[model samples]
Target chain A: MSRRILNLILGCASVCVGLTPMRAQEFKLFERTVQVHGFASQGFIYTNDNNWLTMNTSQGSAAFTDFGLNMSTQITDKFRIGAQGYDRDLGQLGQYHPSLDWAVADYRFKSWFGIRGGKVKTTLGLFTDTQDLDFLHQFALLPQSVYPTDLRDATLAHVGGDIYGNILLQHHLGDLAYTVYAGHRSDSKYSGYSYFLTKYGVTSSSFAGLQYGSDLRWSTPLKGLLIGASRMNEEITDNGNLSLGPGIDFTSYSAVSRADWTNQFYGEYVIRKLQVDSEYRRYLHDQIVSPDSLETISDVRGWYISGCYRITKRLALGSYYSRYSITSVAGGAAAPFFPDQTDTSLPANHVYDKVISGRVDLNKFWSAKVEGHFMNGYGNSSFPDGFYPLANPGGFKPNTNALVLKTSVNF
Target chain B: MKNLRLLPLVAFLVLLAPVRARAAQVKIIANPSVSTDAISGRELKSVFLEEKNSLSDGSHVEPVLLKSGPVHESFLRQYLSRTDDDLRNYYRVLVFTGRGSMPKELGSDAEVVAYVAGRKGAIGYVSAEAGVDGVKTLAITDGRSPVERRVITRIEPEYPETLKRLNIGGIVRLQVTIAPKGNVENVQLLGGNPILGESAVAAVKQWVYATAPSRTRIEVSVPFNPQP
Candidate 1:
């Protein structure tokens, strides 16, 4: 057909060929000064009653996939340039659309001061930095109540500059890491903001927004103990004729903690491992509505506690309980479609999920995981009717069971 | 009669162990750019883990690695306390998170040595017998500052639950050098089960030692034998 179509076909064929054995070897360039790496993953989802990430996954659907390629060059002792291109298909979320995940030019001026400018991965939770790398953890999916995948686009990266540094303290106090960034949030269609609007049937959506925040983490001298707090504020210009009127202000604050403990048995590479991770977030958004001329703030809060123990180096077992609540309805514009209603058939904004998972790391670059989740709420999703199959005979069931299995390979 | 029959086999294994251990011989080497002549166990871990990127003298340091070999395995077990696979995952986290990049991983000791010798601030480990005419061999010193090596605040290692449940017991030996300022400066894993040794090292490194006029080194033995 056309040249574009031909190129697309060839690219697809090349990726397909590379993925059959789906492994990336270390590719070096310029006398090994530059390094390139990549990964691809596919996931299968099954639910008994409701859909977790996509529709019609109850009977099993392979609608989830993530492919990424990244490269970095250490130009000097204190400078480096890196970038990654990623395509994710989670039902209609990414639809295999390619996007720049992150690109940064870094400068480490001193031990206590450094700067990174460009698209930077930005997340405040304990494991949010590794949120996209499924092969690193014991679960196929992170606890969504706190680190929702749907909201990743708008919150996962910042297109501005960030200043970061560390200060080492004495004794048990440990070291402190602080990162502060300022820039406009990503307004891509896959953004959580876009997800919120589209899922709520809000037309004429414009997510152009300005955001800034800082995160401080304290790595205690107590080995694997770490605690941190993060906060970000965003101002969105709706430019919409429907739903959120015009101006929306969102502020998010989170407290995070994590610890890794290895068993003394087996020693070395085969140690039995026990790890605990946690995060709690409070969200406040200023929404405005006309006609009634009502202005109010909605408060949403969520938290999760997770523990994983490695039975062996390659195998790990884990479980977690997560809950999210619309703590306050108050006066804010809870929007029109998914309005603030304490008594409704759809409850609309509360979610609870309990998950148990197991992961088998086949090797350094390959892994497989199986996770089962008992979910009672859909607060994590921005949809009003929810992501479950509408064919439900019971007409809107809040509780459901979902099973997820995934195989991931990263170089 | 059965035990007597296997005596030669046991002796054979005992005598052959040294050969295998020798095959895994390792030494720490650094580029000529690195000015430090010594590194403690703690400092080495921090550098390789991407936690600390510079030496005590503010000299920038980059960690190189041999992809796979007996020397590579032994080096990781001795210093990083990780398996080769674990080390790979660790680098993945760093690169994926945009925190750091994967170090220059060479295929063999010669490759690593050549790379290290040619680059500034490069550090790598290789077989002890590997020819290293260009690179410098840095002595791993336990006594960094003699006056700061005295332990004033001691922390105990928490026995791992899996080990406690299985009733696994051992003593993890560590060589620690106290900083002149009295902070736990460097700790090197000398002997112990790898897993238990990791926990013991983590705990001992957090200890606050008494400061003297100069730094000092001390040997520590942490035992993990949970009581009923």
Candidate 2:
């Protein structure tokens, strides 16, 4: 089935290329062209907990891997299309799961304006939400906070449609470029054996959600340095049902500020929040527990600061520090079942993480990178409970560290 | 025995007298229409090097040269302090970069004289004995204080009796100072083909004195024909 799909994609690409008009005086059918390009990276990961390393459980380590492919073609003088897919393997048991990362067709009205339809990635906050994985300004491993575990895998990619454009402002003060966008998307979820048997008494349930987000970025020159600030908001509606009610409806707001000096030194700071109401519920066995109903309001807040230095034309070094904290206020009938049961008030949990990375450009079309991460305080909170149950207990140490190496090629 | 000795002595004196009395000959010429009193070697160098394209009378002057051979080599060494090989290589780079073109090269001294004399903007050099009616001689300078000497080699190749020509060989060194008006003011032998050095130097000095000074380097070359 996968081979068939790959063949179909290749066939479509060839047809697109064949349809292009050839240049004047040229015998070739197509002078203009389309291309498919992507990259894959795999590495070994060692964690503190042996149970977390599902592959070779006795070995006390895990292998991390990911790969993605993007196909882009110019359909006409004013129209273009692109589709992408990405897969990641947490461990052997988790296997390889692929997601339709993006599928969009864009019509450019002019040099500065455009409109797009189909499944599009939302331009929310900063970083890779709108751009592809390969175009990230930082390392492959993002600041853990802004890209939280739940949001990273839980949020849907390639939303329905979007309208986006940029405005250029050039002045004596400096030059400023602003990008704005609006879009909607659907979300999907996977269930574990225990959750599936105890909760809905089903193996899995696929749900679609409404996603809307907008981002505004402003850039200006101050003291001979270029500085910018951006703010974005996204809300997801839970249309699927749990025992207590519908799945948790949530809203996220993120803000980012950046300063660049002479294109040599750059620093950025970002803050994001994922908030859900108290009516949310999770079904376990014959009982239904309203995790949100017990709380007046609950939200997760995360932020990070990162800086990068260009060591040479093809090499760069960067480092970032990020922190995430979850806060909840308990109330109503379901308060006792929630974690931190001693207090009707929930104790805030925080995770502190730092990452240092280096990148080397092997050529115009190839690059390699290595990064190390140091995390402390709330290692138990990093992964989703349904994915890794052993790491949820409070007995485990809050600290964990890991290293990753990756390489990519594009043409 | 005494009479035989006198005949031998007189014959020896006759042969030695002309050898000792031979003075270096140099040629200098300008277009007949050019009313300027004379041209200095410095002014000539500036024009040939394209540093100054205008003459004293405000007429545009383009310098020409012989493409190759002993004359081309001798002339370039005497005035430009460069060899024909160096000039050709330099032009190759300049042309490739679209900076400039090489100077036009004529076939021989007669052709050079005829071309320069017939064209208003053209300037060229030839043997001292080749000087003709259409061209006039210009002054030259050795670039010494107090104007120590006036040495000019006239190329009257058609009238060999008018000038005694000698060939000196070695590298010729000439220092040229350009004036504010973009013309050559001073020409001095910096060092060269040692065999053609003296005649080359004298001719260059006289040429410097005859030309108007400008704020540009003007270095000219006048090669003496091989001694006949």
User: What DockQ does every candidate get?
Assistant: 0.31, 0.01
Residue B34, candidate 2: Cα error in Å is 52
lDDT of 1: 0.68
TM-score of each: 0.74, 0.47
Candidate 2 chain B weakest ten by summed lDDT? B142-151
Per-candidate iRMSD: 2.0, 22.6
Q: Against the true structure, whose lDDT is highest?
A: 1
Model 1, A31-93: lDDT tens digits are: 556677887777778888766564457676666777788988877788888999988777556
Q: What is the TM-score of chain B alone in each candidate?
A: 0.58, 0.51
Best by DockQ: 1
Off by over 4 Å in 2: A1-32, A49-62, A92-94, A130-140, A153-158, A173-183, A190-204, A222-296, A313-315, A339-348, A379-395, B1-228
| Candidate 1 CAPRI level | acceptable
Global Cα RMSD, each model: 11.3, 22.2
Best by TM-score: 1
